[model samples]
Target: MYFSTSTLLLAALAPAAIIASPVDADLTPEGVPKITSISFSGNGCADPGSAKTSATVLDGTLSTSFSTFKGDSSSNCQIHLQASGAGAGWQVALKEATYHADVTLKPSTSLSFFTTSFWSQDASVTATLKSRIDCAGSDIKDSVTVKQSTATPVWSQCTGDAGYPGILNVNFRPAVTGNEGAYNVKSASIKFEWRKC
Candidate 1:
């Protein structure tokens, strides 16, 4: 009876063990990071067709810039934890991904890749932010484009093998005028974890 019960418990725990990896361990070639929640530290708002500037999209050094949207600067430019889609999310600590954390990534374990998206309520409107993580800590350079769909934000990302770790930062580069859709930069942020095989 005891042996049978032990076998059943081990079988039940097998899936979780396979799914969960040690934070500092190397990731499988196909393993991917599991994110239960996300957090945004800075908030900056800007209206369309305007030359607005914000520093929230920056890292600790406050380097990244925004020159598109024009909105109340005071209203935005703040940082805090917010929900991804639903208010009740996983953990802000993991979401508030600072460069400090990325820099401290396990040296030879796994790599981390990040991406973002843009969302809008108006179908006729569009916006985008491109992240330049080329200089970030990683085994190789990775780039991600955050685009705003019809009132919704969607994202796509890619990464290299081995392990990438370092400071991850993104920038929002606006396109020329007379574009099809008119949109503003609503938000800019980042989250990171190991990209398993």
Candidate 2:
């Protein structure tokens, strides 16, 4: 079977579940960007005892956050974004990918943005294929670590040659195998250049 690159990428992402729909009712044609949905393998709170679900990250409010339970030791999640009328699965020229994190959160968590659709870093198996899926930009080349205090969210702005379908996948996982701690995430947003498709 000759599956196109887009086909393969979408197939890979199909199973992971869509963590957040980047645009929804909260987002009017002119309103603060809002996350629409969120999908996860297992969601809980960083404190282990705190009862918080992944929904906290998509509420469009920084007051709350999403965190993995303390005992899990490892965590992975994905967030998807597209313009209001980008048309399902349409490619979008990304400008920025932003997310908030607590300063105390260790560097163990890394973030990666994909143009097409993908589940994990492993999905970018070959260098050739990896480049295709990777959104090329000075701030986007490597796995982005959570920096800037919770008060200051991490924002990776796209410098050049950012091209991908309306579907942008923000994937995150702890850097270490046993990185047991609060993988706290406040919110995620993607800025795309809107154009008639």
Candidate 3:
């Protein structure tokens, strides 16, 4: 079995009145925000070298591939990301996320995928997405999307911890039960929205 995952971060800046000056060090040539650092943990990435980021900060794109990621019974991975270039008085929020996967399940077998995303400062403002498949046979493709509420968006810390990057933690779990099955996650992407404090 072969499993690979990649993450792409996209940002949309709010109105000019809400956004301050851009942080030169955190922006790419096109003025887009960049992911400065990313770390992975959990049983899915037990091998130190199995997971790696392929894109650089200058690319304004961050991608990770897992050479040995597969789900037979259960597998989980946690990803922590810190981004820069939102400006001095602005903060980031997770607007949406989409995950794609390919799975194969025998009769009476089922697979479930669950994801939880939240900012480090406040866990109350969190978003989650769950998907389940039952006896889907071989070569089944799946995709799930989770969107946050716009009326009451959860913003990152803006004042108390000034200069600290807005942090987002995402955890993904794939579980299988009943008979036997195979699951492989293809990719996942996150979209960010920025606003002033």
Candidate 4:
């Protein structure tokens, strides 16, 4: 078969054109929300000096060292995160969260950790993990991860206003008043996922 130089050049460029085509808007890097600011509140972080927050494009984290988080008491903390880049016709949601802690529990004591997350103008979801000790002098260092179901994802509001930020609340509650226990929350992080509005 006879092929012209122009024809061969067009064929050679066809594959490149296909490769350079636009990808799915949902898969774009811009869909990933960036955490612009973070703030901490509540009794768990009462000493603001003991809490720290850091953020990235896809996730945000809060770490705290508690001095008074001890026996028969409950501590609570609220994390406020301002997410940007998703305000442009995009919405974000909490895909998953991980909580890590170091706990020492006396016999017949139980500890529970709860996390609730929500965005402005959105409903919240809570996840909980519990630990119990039957033996004395029990020291536990562990982490729990909670994943949101894709079928019922709680998405952020489609608003361009920066005033609306995501909120995450954590509560640590201990049971059995007679026993002594200590809890130190090492860190907690939430991974965000986004989609077109």
Residue 134 accuracy (lDDT) in model 4: 31
Each model's total of backbone clashes = 23, 14, 0, 0
lDDT of 3 by residue, 49-152 (tens): 77676654423333456656677888877788876654466566554444455566677787766666778878777765555566644543343222222223
lDDT of 2 by residue, 1-197 (tens): 11222221211112332324342323312222334444333343324423223332221322223544222244544444422322332222333334443222223332222222332323452110011122222212221222211111121222122222223344433322222223344443433332222
Q: Locate the minimum summed-lDDT window of 10 residues in model 4.
A: 7-16
Cα deviation at 56, candidate 2, in Å, is 16
**lDDT, residue 1, model 4:** 13
By summed lDDT, the worst window of 10 consecutive residues in model 1 runs over: 6-15
Better of 1 and 2 by lDDT: 2
Residues forming the 10-long window of minimal summed lDDT in candidate 2: 126-135
Over 101-157, each residue of candidate 1 has an lDDT whose tens digit, in order, gives 111111122222222223222223222222212212333211222322111222112
Cα TM-score per model: 0.20, 0.32, 0.64, 0.59
Q: Compared to the true structure, candidate 1 yields what TM-score?
A: 0.20
- Please rank every candidate by lDDT, starting with the best: 3, 4, 2, 1
